[model samples]
Target: MKNVSTREPGLHKGVLYAMLAAALFGASTPFAKVFVGQVAPVSLAGVLYLGSGVGLLACFLVRALVQRGQVGQPVALTKPDLPWLAGAIAAGGVAGPVLLMVGLSMMPASSASLLLNMEGVLTAMLAWFVCKENFDRRIFIGMLLIVAAGALLSWEQVPVLGVPWGAFAILGACLCWAIDNNLTRKVSASDPLQIAMVKGLVAGIVNIAIALAFGYALPGAGTALAAGAVGFCGYGLSLVMFVLALRHLGTARTGAYFSAAPFVGAAISLIMLAEAPGATFWIAAALMGGGIWLHLTESHGHEHEHEAMEHLHAHSHDGHHQHEHDFEWDGSEPHAHPHQHVPQRHAHPHYPDIHHRHRH
Candidate 1:
């Protein structure tokens, strides 16, 4: 029996990336709320996406120039990846932001930010049921707590409408994002910058075009620029980190770490919007905090199989990568290349990372 019991090398990096992505995304919610009334929802969404697209495009260009002809460069997207990328863009890029903007217009930023936690629960559900990712009681219980918190956060005493339509819209946004998260996982092995950049540009352009056709007036230059800057950090960089996390953490776990985003958003909302938290907010916060803790503490280890396969991604000479290179390669620690995996079996702590997607 192989006795190589160690934590997956990517675990810490994945967690950090996931949390940073959460912080950027969470902070974006309140900032977006700042523009709620100044610009039309659809138009604001368009501006934000456009900003991310434009910003990332510049970054992509610079990185390409700097890394020109680098041998170990990240793999580019291929034909088969297009469908997954397109689906992710449509769900997350086009629909998610629009719904979030509309919801922000109707509710407090803090409340809207907290409500976005529903995305984690939804993402986990899809990962477990549809994508067949493994899970345990801890994950299930954590998801339940998050779901309960979302319900409590959204609940209102309105006689005619039990819940505010704003809550529904935000929840709808969460669903779209959940779908996007899963779809993006299908192409997580590609260059994350390219993936994020394409998503930003396509989604941004489509949203802006739709908004213009629908007669929504564009915001002033200052407002547009502000929205764009927010998008670059919140949407563009955050998404790049998110895709990186997905490669190491898988969809559900990444979503769990990313769930912390709402807390960051809620805190920013309080400071920026001067919103006072009521008992509901505190209770929901506690519940969400507990749920995140559960996920963070999770660990899984067992003898799992790795089937023979061929793919490309950035990796170092870890246990999973024991193949010989055919080229006279400079000995770089982490590099990307087309490689093949020989079937193997062993036991160690693991996530549903790129190389460890066997059915449990």
Candidate 2:
């Protein structure tokens, strides 16, 4: 097995990246909501996604050019990887943002913020089932609590008419993201930047086309600038961070940490939109906070094991023989010592004077 310590520093890095990504993602909702009021949802969504896609693509292109004359060739995209890439674009790039923008337009920022929590539950379930990852009873219970909290937080805000479609669209967005997470995992061995760029470019084109077809009206100068900024921070930077997180944290943990985004968004909405949250919102936030704590704490066991291993060493010596043993002999005087050996485990204190028989 790969050493956990070696993996842990990266995981810590991933956690930091994931948290920042969640914060950026959360901030985007309020900003997007601001634009949704002034511009057609589809048009704004199109520009946001397209701009993010183009930004990522440009970064990828620049990197590729820089590395063209390097030792190893630039990472190549294979035919087999296309389907996964396509799926990520369709779900994360195209559908998720489009639905999110539309939903924000129709729903109150607070309600929409709460509804966004469903993404984590959906993502965790899909990753657990489809990706065949480990999901213990605790994780399952935590997920249920999160779902329950979401329902409670948004219960009163659920619309009575034309709401089902919007709800369905939002749910579909979650599913798309779930699919995107798993698909991205399948191709995680490649350079994350390259994968992100491809998904962004392809999905951006498709979303823009769809937006235009749906008769989305273009926004004015200020709205356009705001939308672009939101897209760059939320879509572009967030994705890059997410991809990096996935490298160490894997989909399940990544989803768990990302569950905070909605709550963060809700807070942002409350501040920026001057929206007042009810008692239920506070309760839900507490539950979500507990969930995050549990998720982060669960990794302590792994860290403990790693720490223990780093400080200990094992060696072999013969108690029966006075001198170094070369070979095994049956109860004979002046018996030959059959074997002499020393072994060292890295990242542990060495015992120079101690020698003992190898234990089975």
**Most TM-score-accurate candidate:** 1
**Per-residue lDDT of model 2, residues 37-105, tens digit only:** 677766777777766777777787888788675533434566677888788877887878788767666
Q: Give lDDT tens digits, candidate 1, residues 83-116.
A: 9999999999888988887887787766775577
Residue 77, candidate 2: Cα error in Å is 3.8
Would you give me the overall lDDT of model 2?
0.63
lDDT of each: 0.85, 0.63
- CA deviation > 4 Å runs, candidate 2: 1-11, 61-76, 97-115, 145-165, 273-281, 300-360
TM-score of every candidate: 0.89, 0.71
Error of 2 at 313 (Å): 32
Worst 10 residues of 2 by lDDT: 349-358
How many angstroms is residue 174 displaced in model 2 relative to the true structure, after the best TM-score fit? 2.2
